[model samples]
Target: MRTAYGVETVRATERQLMARLPEGTLMQRAAAGLAVASADLLGRVYGSRVVLLVGSGDNGGDALYAGARLARRGAGVTALLLAPERAHAGGLAALRRAGGTTVHSPAGGRAAGATEGAADRPAGGSASDPAERPAGGPAGPTAAEVLIERADLVLDGIVGIGGKGGLRPDAARLAEAAERSRAAVIAVDLPSGVDADTGQVHGAAIRADLTVTFGTHKPGLLIDPARDFAGTVRLVDIGLDLPEEPALEALQHADVARLLPVPGPESDKYRRGVVGIAAGSARYPGAAVLAVAGALHGGAGAVRYVGPAGDAVLARFPETLVSDLGPAKAGRVQSWVVGPGAGDDAATVAQVLEADVPVLIDADGLRLADRDTVRARTALTLMTPHAGEAAALLGVARAEVEGARLSAVRELAARYRATVLLKGSTTLVAAEEGAVRVNATGTSWLATAGSGDVLSGLAGSLLAAGLPARDAGSVAAYLHGLAGRYAADGAPVGAQDVAKAIARAWRDVRD
Candidate 1:
C-alpha cells in the first residue's frame, strides 16, 4: 500500500525532523534529490538552458539550489525571479557562486539580468550596470516569456503545496508561456495553483511533465484534478518520521494480492462461499448476465441469482442457480449483490437489506435502496456509484462530485454508515472512517454500458468470501480495473470482455 499525508501532517513532521537536524541539512537533502531528478530528465546537463521560476518561499529555495548544482555542471542556468528581494538569500548566493545568473521578471521594475550579488548588487552596480549584463541587454516585457520558450527545461516553483486558489495574473501568464514552450516542465514538490490537501484546482495551474516530491506523497498528488495536473510523480525520501495513520491509501499489486482469498485443502463449494445476485428486469436482462459473468470469475465458489432475468442469466451462465422467489427465499448465500438493472425494484432492495449478510449495492439499486434501512443494517453495506449517481445521493451537481471525489466519497460513507466506492478517473473506496483507498488501474475504455454491473458482482463475491466491506470494495476495484486494462489493450472493449479478463488479472496479481 502507498500512503499519502495531508499538508498539516507533513509540516508537523518536517518541524520535528528539522529540530533534530542541522539548520540547512533538510534543504540540502531536498536540493540534492531535486538536482538528480532534473539531471535524469535533462539527459545531458552541460550547455542546456535551464530556467527557474522563483517565488518567495522555500519552494523557490529548492529550485534555486538545484539550479546551482546544474550550473556547476556547465548548464546556462537563469533564475527568473518573480520576487527578487524575497527570494531565498542563501540559495541566491549559492547559484551565483556556481556561475548561474539571475533575471527579474519585467513586472519587477527591472529588465532581464539585473544581477544581485552575494550580499549586494554587484558592488555599487545597478540594473543598468554594463559590467554585469546578459548577452542581450535589457529585454522588455517579453523577456521572461522568451527565456522560458528557449529553455530546455523549466522548473515551476511559482507556488508550492501551501499555495491555494490558483495562480495570480502574472504567474498565470508565465504558466501559459511554459505550456506553449517545448521545454520539459518539472514542478518542484507539486504543480503550483493546486490544493495540496484536497487536490482541487480553482483556477490556472502549472502542467508538469514530472513532479519530484520530497519526504512523502501529498494527498493532492494521488487524487484527481490536482492529479491530472501532476503528471509522473517521483517521491524523494528526506527521512521524516510520519504518524501511522495516513490521509489516503492506494493498493498496488502486492497489496491486492495479499488481500485475495485462497481456498484451503478442505474447502468445498459451500465452504468457499456463495454470492447471491439480485439484479436485472425484463427491460435489462443483460445486466444480470454480465453481473453473473463477473461473479463466476471472482473467486466465489458458487453463485445464486434471484431476479426476473433468470432465463437470460441461465442461458449465459448455466452454472448459476436461478430462482424467482425473490432474495428472501433465495436459499442460503454468504453475501448479496443488489441493484444493477432492477429498475424501480424497491421491494427487492429492501429485502436484501433485511438479510443478516453483507450487501453490495449499485446502479438503479442506489436509487431504490432506502437510506434509513441501509443505515439500520447489522451487516456491512458497500455502495458503488459513479459521479452522477453519487451526485444524486449527495443532492449536488455531477461536476461537484467529480471535482472533489475524496470529499464526496467520504461524506456518502458517513451519511449512509456504509462503505462507498465512487467510480471515476480515480476510483475511491471509503468507509465512515479510516484511510480512503484509491484505484487507478482502470482504463478509459472501461466506461462501456453495464461495466458497473460487473464491478458490483465482483465486489459482492469478495464480500461473500469474507473480506471486510472496505477490503472487498477496494480489492474488487483493483481487479476490475486491471481486467479493464487487459481487455481493452488500447482499444474498445465490451463489459463481457472485461469480465472474461478477471482471471487473467487475478493471475497477474497472484504471480
Candidate 2:
C-alpha cells in the first residue's frame, strides 16, 4: 500500500522529527533531495543554468539551498528573491557563498545585469547605490521570470505546508511565467496553490514536471486536479517518527492481489461461497443478465438469481439457480447483491436487505430503500451509488457530489453505516470507519449505461468470497475498472462487454 499523509499530519510528523534532529536538519534533507532531483532533470549540473524562485518560507529556503548545491557543482545558478529581506537567512547566505547571483528590483537590477535605462530592470543589490541602479520602469520582467525563461530548469519554492490556499500576486505571476517557459519545472514538496488535503486547486498552481516530497506522500499528490498538476511524484525520506494515522493509503496491484480470493484445491463450490443476486425485472432483463455475467466471473463459487427476470438470467447464464421466491427464499448465500435494473421495486429491495448475509446495494436499490433500515443492518453492507443516485441519497445536488467526491463518499458511508462506493471520474470507496480508497484506473469510456450493475454484482461476489466489506468493495472496483479498460481497448464498449472483460481481468490479476 502507498500512503499519503494529510498536511496537518505531515506537520505533526515534521515537528516530532524536528525535536530529535538538528534545527535545520529536515530542511537540509529536503534541499539535498531536491537538488539531486533538479540535477537529474538538468541531465548534467556542470554548465547548466538553473533558476530558483525563492519565496519567504521554508519552501524558498529549500530552493535557495538547492541552488547553492548546484552552483558549487559548476552550474550557473541565480536566485530571484521575491522577498529578499524576509528570505531564509541561512539559505541566502549559502547561495551567495556558493557563487549564485541574486536579482532584485530594477533600482537594484544593474548589479545583476541590466542596461542603464530599460523597461526591464536587473534585480538584487542596493537601489540606493547609484552605480547599481538601473533607469527602467521596474526590474526587467522580474528576476524570476527572466531567469526562468532563460534557464534550463526552474525550481518552485513559492509555498510550503505553512502556506494557505491560492498564490500571492508575485508567486502567481512567477508561476505563469514558468509555465510558459521551455524550462522543466521541479516543485519542492507539493506544487504551490493546491490544497494538500483535498487535492483542490485553490487558484493557479505551478504545474511541475516532477515533485520531490520529503518523508512521506501528501494526499494531494495522490489525488486528482493537484495530481494532474503534479506530473510525477518522488518521496525523499527525512526520518520522521510519525504516528499511524498520518499514513493515509493507496492500494497497488500487489495489495489487491493479496486481498483477492484464491480458491484452494480442497474448496468445494458451496465451501467457497454463494452470492444471491436480486436484480432486474421483465421490463429490463438485460440488467439481470449483465449482473449475473459479472457475478459469474467473480470469485464466488455460485450465484443464485431471485427476481422477475429469472427467465432471462437462466437463458443467459444457465449456471445460475433461478428462483422466484425472492431473496428471502434464495437459499443460503454468503452475500447478496440488490438493485441494478430492479426498477424502483421497493418490496424486492426490502426483501434483499432483510437477508442475513452481507449485501451490496446499487442502482435502484440505492433509491428504493429506507436509509435508516440500511443503517440498522447487522451484516456487512456496501452501497454503490453513482453521483446522481448518491446526490439523492444524501439529499444534495448531483453537482455537489461531483464537485467534492471525497467528502460525498465519506458522508454516504457514515450515513448508511456501510462501505460507500461513489463512482465517477475518480471512483472513491469509503468505509464507515473512515478508511478511503481511490481507484486510479479505468477509462472515461466505462461510463456506459448498466456498467455499474456489473460492478455491483462483482463486489457482491467478492463479499460472498469472504473479503471484508471495505476490501471487497475496493478490490471489486479495481477489477471492474480494469475490465472496463480491457473491454474498451480505446474504443467505446457496452456494459455487457465490460462484464465479459471481467473474466479476462480476473485472469490478468490471478496469473
Candidate 3:
C-alpha cells in the first residue's frame, strides 16, 4: 500500500531529522535529486538552457542549489530572483561559485555583476550588449515569459510548505507564463499554490509535468483537485524517520491480489460461501437479473435470490435458487445484498437487515433505511452510496458530496459504524477506523443505468467469500473498474455487458 501523510506530520518529521543531522544536509539531498530529475526532463543537460523561478523561502533555496548543480555540468542556468536579497544566502553563493548568473527585478536597479566581476548593464541591455544575457524587470509576466519561452525547462520554486493556499500575484503570473511555454515544468516538493494538507486549490496553481517531493508523499498529491495539478509524483528520500499517521492511501495491484479470497482445496461448495440477494420488483425485474449476474460471477459458491423478480432471475441465471420468502428466510447465506431495483420496499429491506450474515445495502435500500435501525445492526454492514444517494443519507446537497468526496465517504462510515463506498469519478472506500482507499481505475463509459447494482452484488459476494467488509468493498471496486475498462475497450457498454465482463476481470486478477 502507498501511504500519504498530512503536512503537519511531514513538518514534524522534518524537524526531528533536522535536529539530528548536520546543517543543510537535507536540503543538499533534495537539491541533488532535483538536479537528476531535471536532467531526465531535458534529455541532455549539457548546453541546455534552464530557468529557475526563485522565490523568498527555502523553496527558492532548493531551486538555486539545483541550478548550481546543472550549471557545473555545462548547462546555461539563470536564476530569476523574485526576492534577491532575501533569498537563501548560502544557496546564492553556491550558484555563483558554479558559474550560475542571477538577474534582479527591474525595480531593484542593476548592481555590479558579482560573480562575473563586471559592472551591471542597463535593464534590457544596450544594442552592444550580448543578446543571450537576461534583463530582469519586476519578475512579472513579461520577464518570466521571455525567460520561460526561451528555456528548455522551467523549475517552479515559487512556494513551498511555508506558503499558504494559492499563488502570490507575481508567482501566479510567472506560472501562467510557464504554462504557455513549451518547456516541461518541474515543481519542487509540490505544485505551488495548493493546500498541502487538504488538496484544495485556493486560486491558480502551477501544473507540473513532474514533481520531486522530499522524504515522503503528501496527502495533496494523492487526493483530487490538487492531485489533478500534480502530474507525475517522484519521492526523494531525504532520510526523515516518520511516524504512522497516514492521511490517505492508494492500493496497488499486489495489495488487491493479497486481499482477494481464494478458496482452499479442502473447501466444499457450502464452505466456499453463499450469497443471498434481495433485489428487483415487478416494475424493474432486470435489476434482479443484473444483480444476480454480478453475484454469480463474483466469487460466491451459490447465489439465492429472494424478491418479486425471482422468476426473472431464474430465467436468466437458471442456476440461482429462487425463493418466495424474503432474505431473512432465504435459508442459509454467508452474506446478504439488499436493494437494487426493489423500489421503496421497506419490508424487504428490514427483513434483509435482520439476517445474521454480513449485509451490503445499496440503491433503493439506502433510501428505505432508518438511521437508528442501520446503526443498531450487529452484523458488519457495508453501505454503497453514489453521490446522490449519499447526499440524501447525509442530509446534504449532492454538490456538497461531489466537492469533498473524501470527507463525505468517511462521514458516512463513521456515522453508520460501517464501511462506506462513495462511487464517482474516483471511487472512495472509507471504514469506521478512518482508513480510506481511492480506486483509480474505470472509464466514464461505466456510467450505465444498472452498473451500481452490479457493484453492490459483487461486493456482497466477496463478503460471503470470507473477505472482511472493507476489503470486500475495495476489491469489488477494483474488479468492477477493471471490468468496465475491459468491456468498454473505447466503446460504450451497457450494464449487462459490464456484468458479463466481471468473469474476465476475476480471471485477469487471478492470473
RMSD of each: 4.4, 6.3, 6.4
Model 1, poorest ten-residue lDDT window?
116-125
In model 1, what is the error at residue 392, expressed in angstroms?
0.6
lDDT of 1 by residue, 197-307 (tens): 888888788999999999899999988888989999999999989999999899999999999999999998788889999999999999999888888889899999999
Off by over 4 Å in 1: 106-141
Pick by lDDT: 1 or 2, better one? 1
Q: Report lDDT per candidate.
A: 0.86, 0.79, 0.81
In model 3, the Cα lDDT at residue 135 comes to: 57
Candidate 3, residues 1-511: lDDT per residue as tens digits?
7787777787778777777877888788999999999998899999999998876666677898999999999999887776565556667777878988776533232111111110111112212213223454443456647878888988987677645657756567678878888989999998887767666677777899999998888877766667777889999998878777578777777888888777899987678789999999999898889889889888889999999998888878999989997676678999999989989899989888877779999999999977788888888899999999999999999977875777888899999998999898678889888888877678899999999989988999999998888889989999999999999999999988998998888788777
* lDDT, residue 306, model 2: 89
Task: Candidate 2: list runs displaced more than 4 Å.
Answer: 104-143, 149-151, 489-491, 507-511
Name the lDDT value of residue 327 in candidate 1. 92
- 308-335, model 2: which lDDT tens digit per residue? 9988888888899888887787689999
CA lDDT, candidate 2, residue 338 = 89
Full ranking by lDDT: 1, 3, 2
Error of 1 at 273 (Å): 1.3
lDDT of 1: 0.86
Clashing pairs in 3: 106-137, 106-138
Best by TM-score: 1
